[model samples]
Target: MTNDENQELKRDKEILSHIQHRYDEEERRFQSVDTKISSMIGVLAVIFTIQASLFINILSNSKPDICLIVLFIFSLALYLISIYYFIKSHYFKKFSATPKPSFLMEEGAKKESEHTIVKDMIALYSDCINDNEKLIENKTNIAKKGFSFLIYGGCLSFIFLLCFLLELFV
Candidate 1:
């Protein structure tokens, strides 16, 4: 092989290495975001379970009204914050887009296997990004629903408190 040919081969190797590095980086980012979202879900589930317990306790007590009202307000705040984190995490997952490789192989092209691998890597990255985008969109909708529920619950709790206060004082 000529010097020029050797230089081209080295350059191609470097390019391939760079692409692989980028792919690895993107995969790590994707996993990190997935982990965060999973953690958030677990936390929200725990919060919900605790709130349910609080509600049950308040209902079973003799002087339940005030306690229920206070607990509901606190739960509403927590729900709101959880929803915010949910949305933020969804956005992070959505916006972490990675560039796709664009090395096409023609007839009689050298390094066909390497080129094909790069193309496959690009396709994999594209698919992952698409899936993440869909997941984030769904999560965003769910978060909105959760926010609405929190608002309604808070209002109802406040109204209950008002009634209880009226009955007690007036």
Candidate 2:
């Protein structure tokens, strides 16, 4: 092959390598978002347990305060909503990956030029990257809403706990 042809082939390979790397990076980012969602779920579980136990204690008392009951109900409702969103975000949605091996093999057997194959693969990689990024963005937005609910629920719980303590000591 001519020197110019060799250089062009090398450049195509380099471009393919960069596209593959970008695809991998997007996958890693998706996993990172999953990890964060899992962590949030864990914390919510702990908070739910504490809230349930405290609420039960309050309800069992003969003279349970009406305000405490209302606060607990609101807090628990918010937590449930938050959990729903968190679980929704955590659901295993399908991600776009590279073309299957069989397809690649078929392409190889077609006797297509290497440059053509590389360009096609680059296009596939770009599509996958775009799809995965959109999924990640959606998950991120859902998680943010869940986080907001969690914070609001926590505030309600704190108020309930403070009132409970006041009633106990006074």
Per-model CA lDDT versus the true structure: 0.59, 0.88
Tens digit of lDDT per residue, candidate 2, span 72-164? 899999998899899999994867778879869988899998878887888888888999999999999999889999999999989988998
Model 1 lDDT, full chain set: 0.59
Candidate 1 lDDT tens digits, 59-153: 56645565556656665665656656665655553444444233333313555554445555556556655665566566656655655655665
Q: What's the distance in Å from true for residue 111, model 1?
A: 8.4
The residue ranges of model 1 lying beyond 4 angstroms of the native Cα positions read 59-170
Q: Which pairs clash (backbone N, Cα, C closer than 3 Å) in model 2?
A: none
Regions of candidate 2 where Cα sits further than 4 Å from its true position: 1-4
Model 1 poorest 10 in a row by lDDT: 99-108
TM-score of each: 0.47, 0.90
lDDT of 2: 0.88
- Top candidate (TM-score): 2
